[model samples]
Target: MQDQTFPWLTTLIVVPLVGAAVLWALPSALRRFARPVAVAFSLVVLALAAVATSTFDVSTAGTHQLREQTEWIPAIGASYALGVDGVGLALVLLSVVLVPLVLLAAWREHPDAPATGRAAVLGGDRIRHYMALVLVLEACMVAIFAARDVFLFYVVFEAMLIPVYFMVGAFGGLRRRYAAVKFLLFSLAGGLVMLAGVIALYLNGPGGPQGFLVENLIGTQMSTTTERLIFLAFFLAFAIKAPMWPVHTWLPDTAEQAPAGTSVLLVGVLDKVGTFGMLTLCLPLFPEASRWAAPVIIVLALISIIYGALLAIGQTDLMRLIAYTSVSHFGFIVLGIFAFTSVSIQGASFYMVNHGLSTGALFLLAGFLVARRGSQRIADFGGLQKVVPVLAGTFLVAGLSALSLPGLSTFVSEFLVLVGTFGANRPAAVVAALGVVLAALYVLLTYQRVFTGPVRDGLATTPDLSLREKVVVAPLLGLMLALGFYPAPALDLLREPAEQAMELVGVQDVEPAYTSTSTIDDGSDQ
Candidate 1:
């Protein structure tokens, strides 16, 4: 809060936009400049976020940092407010870190993307434009995570669709147009529904003295029916974005359709929107409704967990399988949220960050394999372990992390979730625990089938991961290990925020086996 502490939010929000603009202005003739420019821009943002993180007082992370609140539409009582609490700050850092990695993920020379059919559609500065779109999307994500005002959050939330719409439509695979259209239509309809909730929150809010800032909206009274409806409106929007289950039909399509980089961001960062909205808005704004809807949400989350994994088990397309796996992982996150306990909430938060790191790594590594093998089909791969030891090893590490192997980041967080959920809802927790087992099955099975089999004669020439690919994957694996060993610092960061969240939800005084981690559910579905 000190004046000299740094304008952290501004730096995070602006650097990407500025970098993106410059990259866009660069001559298309200088095609080689695009990726580097994009990476450099992201690194600067990452550096700034790192400085903010390091200098940040971890103990006080529950409090918003370096907030900037200014009147936007005074008549409407909405303001342009920027702030980062423990959870938001953590996700912001994750989002920032992934940008450069995403750029680097697909740094390899890919095929010219079959210009034969869509020559007219794919014309001009395509690569640079893609890079620019990535930057733009990153900016929007940071803004969404940092925005303290619900209305501002909605703006950034909806705006993120643009870049992704193009990413899928532009750089995707076969059926890319279909996937893009589906993604766009689903996301837009959800945003519109959420917009109605935003308007209702603004217009019907406690208007005696101030406006509809999130800080003020909490604990405001609403009839249970109204709260439930508004909560449904909000939850529907986020769920579609989370792409949970039946609605999640788009994820595999989108993932299979998008380029590797786009999939990483889409699944890794963008999908977090759904879980994040629940934690940030839905539960707090409608606690009674959240409680009322808890059973249905938990059931749906369990289904997503089971169904996505089941779908993944049957997948032949590696990318589509990964996509389905995300839907399942999202199920865990949602369960943690609606569980309504501190440990579950914290676990959900940690899971989001971990999912970003691990899944992001998987998508990137998958992209690498696809690039070298020339196909994403499981049948296209036979024995890869013998040919690409490093690639196989990295894939194994990413796979283990995805499966929440003990001592990995996800293991600690997910364990806390199961433990915490057990404290609140034993049945749901038990059902969810089966998800962990299923996760292991899917990830390990996928790895075994794709990487451990005998080398198909055709891919006998598949080279090991190059130095650049190794460099890109190493940090993700390392972070997984580091966080697994020492999650205390992160736990401390979430403590106060989780406490405050619990207080609002009327959950209190629950003793747990683990003294450190707090976990709970945010009401999303139903």
Candidate 2:
């Protein structure tokens, strides 16, 4: 047997830490340099990920790649072991992709904040601090995806709270402090609960060569009670992050309160932490309990779909409306995962990346509109297409993508999810598809209200997107088009790792029938 020792996983963690340290150490006079430095660091990591991914031998995906294992604490049976399969690698790439784009979304723009009682989309006065926080937040998000150790995962998980908290509290909209507090309380409480679960997993694992590594957590013998408790503890934490129904009150407020750049990352990548945890930790660690809890979770997912849609329809603020739609989208992602069909799981994974890109773009475009028009009320943005044709067109593409228009990336992944879910659970899939219909309504409704009608008075005839904003959105739009047109390459990269994840979770040999992804080439290029 060949023993290949790669420090790639550690680099993923270390690169971000290096970026954060530089951002902190550099004086405010050099703050202008942070965005590019952060982007450069992120791109380097993405490149490293690509190399790791390129050399991956898919036929043997059941094995870990670029692994780095070392003992951290002798007493707790824990070690600093890290590695990636398909899921972690894909999310890590997605996180890297979004971080630079988010900084670009705010480039050349200041955070001129709105007052306490107003309805503003993206507003704040502290541009430097907001940008710095965003970079730091990206580092934390990347850590979450790259972390393979259970303890490291928990630390990074809670560490994410601080940057986003400041982003919301200091530079957000009218109720920034309130939203920040709400976000912190909900997150802190959940993290504490999950910490207990992580400790329990460490304590309960079978002694052997395999310990504290997610890949080694299979076939453990735990009582039904312990499994249930562990599952619930972790579930609650992820749920808040997932912002799933009932526990999701914090999301809309945070989205509404945070600046646009912050909201983009919040919805785009941070919220994914919850679903990722569900897929990575909850299902694999407590397989039987996940099965036990599936029915209950599915029910919550269904409710979130309906509730998110209804709330989105009722929202007047543009950013808040976008936030609510995320709730609905998250329900679909959750539903697919718990459904446990092979195709559904693949679709779930694909959905995470696709939704992140499409939704992140929409939030960015919406921010541009909000800043120019000085209001997020749908009534405030009429005939925008007349003054800013380019901006209107950009928003339209993102909006269409959000509604899963055929040939767009979202359509491909969401179709797979609905079909796969239908195969696994027909009734749930039926109702979930309704969420798709509501998606169209919400997306188009927002578009019509914001872009059609006569140009309202008092609105600035803002120019089209600046070079920086275009530089950011252009890649996103191109990416959406490219993926919508052809997804085989990405899917091929993902296949082996996802397959391996299934095996470790004891669901080996469960490949989704729809997993072939022939539809990516079926023709639809608008």
Candidate 3:
């Protein structure tokens, strides 16, 4: 929303990268300050994000704002372009907000280790490598969301895997290498597929530099078959990232192996790329294909919703459970987008933001529990509420939010998604609604096993949330509550984008088949 004249988006992207470079270059003796430095840089970015949002002109909501551009790769029609629409801005802001918190949560991960995988990877300079990667990850995520050029987005999209790969492979649990490779392979396979689409778009595009800019690509003429093929390529990549069913195999393994902070970013923010791509690229670029594919996509979304929830309910590992829930949540997002109505698209957009906050909190808090207990198994501890009330309480709130409790932030978006889906596809909506019930079962069932039952031995010794940990989680929890109660501002920002999206696809809300008075008069006549 801020003026493009200010260059805030570039600053937001560049600062973290600069911080990462600084952290990497620091002398070994000073590496201990890496966490603080990372946090400071991330906080500045967050502040800049806030400032950008403060200046955003919601009245011009549907189009990209705060545009910045320069020539790059003229041969390929790519540019050093950056901008944000409401949806993209929300995702960028979410990344900035979560990075600082993730750094804080991971603060002690390097320090307390004497001889661990993390210690081995960075040797004595554990903090530097860890925090530097976090900042780099933040930079890439911002670039992905802010990119106005399709080629640039693809570059950043694949580039994002680098930091995450190291974070998980070098710094994670025993099977970290395996999980990291699985993640990379899955992502690369998708990326390669999407690259085909990108190349196709470029070849078929309008002449000159304007071809790759999103603004130019919209509504470009293409044959039905070519559009469908490109749509499939792009959708495959996004679906793998979204981890929608069949293609979702890598997520649970990675979540179970990666550190809590890494898992948080992977699921909370990066995965949003899939649904975001669907809304931003797939529908607009290939409107007819999207409509043609809607029925199949909606069915897949419905399957993910129910299947993910079921798997979560059956999980014994806490992290795996959380990972499965995301599959379910992402289903809601995809369903909303393909439902082809204003309310559904807006709900999907808002859901992206809310899910990031709520799920990020859940992962961080769960990390704390794992750190204290030295285990990731859900059955490893019980009746924690009596021992660590604050920690247990925080977990409860986050879990409830995950299940879409009535007043939680997730609830608002989830409700909108279902309502919107019902309008577009009643059968899919009906099946997807069952996911809510399954969600409750998983959240409550996990709680009952880990927090509510009789206190197990050694549980009493588990410490309550320290002030630093509480400070780390407070903002996320507060945000969940705030958005839950007052979602109007978010809805306002999302409304125009949703309207524009609807316009792009030539969709409008369908009036109800029968009005109340008309139904009554027909009944009386009968």
Tens digits of lDDT, candidate 1, 1-526: 6433456887788899998899878865776777788899999999888888876677787777768777888777778888888988888988998889887775554445433221112224676777888899999989999988888889888899999998889777767899899999999889999999887776668753246678789877777778888899999999999878778988888898788888999999999989999888887888888888889999999999989988888999988999988998999999888888888888888999999999999998998887776678887786889888899998999999988998889898888788888888888988888888888888888888887767787788877877888888999999999999987877787777777677777766356646546656566654
Model 2 error, position 394 (Å): 1.2
Which model, 1 or 3, shows the larger TM-score? Answer: 3
Which 10 residues in a row give candidate 3 its minimum summed lDDT? 114-123
After superposing candidate 3, which stretches have Cα over 4 Å from the reference?
Answer: 1-3, 110-124, 512-526
TM-score per candidate, in order? Answer: 0.93, 0.90, 0.96
Pick the winner on lDDT between candidates 1 and 3.
3
User: Compared to the true structure, candidate 3 yields what TM-score?
Assistant: 0.96
Candidate 3 local lDDT, 225-341, one digit each (tens): 999999999999999999899899999999988888899999999999999899999988999999999999999999999999999999988999999999999999999999998
- Tens-digit lDDT track for model 2 on 400-438? 888889888888878877887777677999999899889
Clashing pairs in 3: 1-55, 1-56
Ranking of all predicted structures according to TM-score, beginning with the best and ending with the worst: 3, 1, 2
Q: How does residue 525 of candidate 1 score in lDDT?
A: 50
In order, what is each prediction's RMSD in angstroms?
5.7, 6.2, 2.4
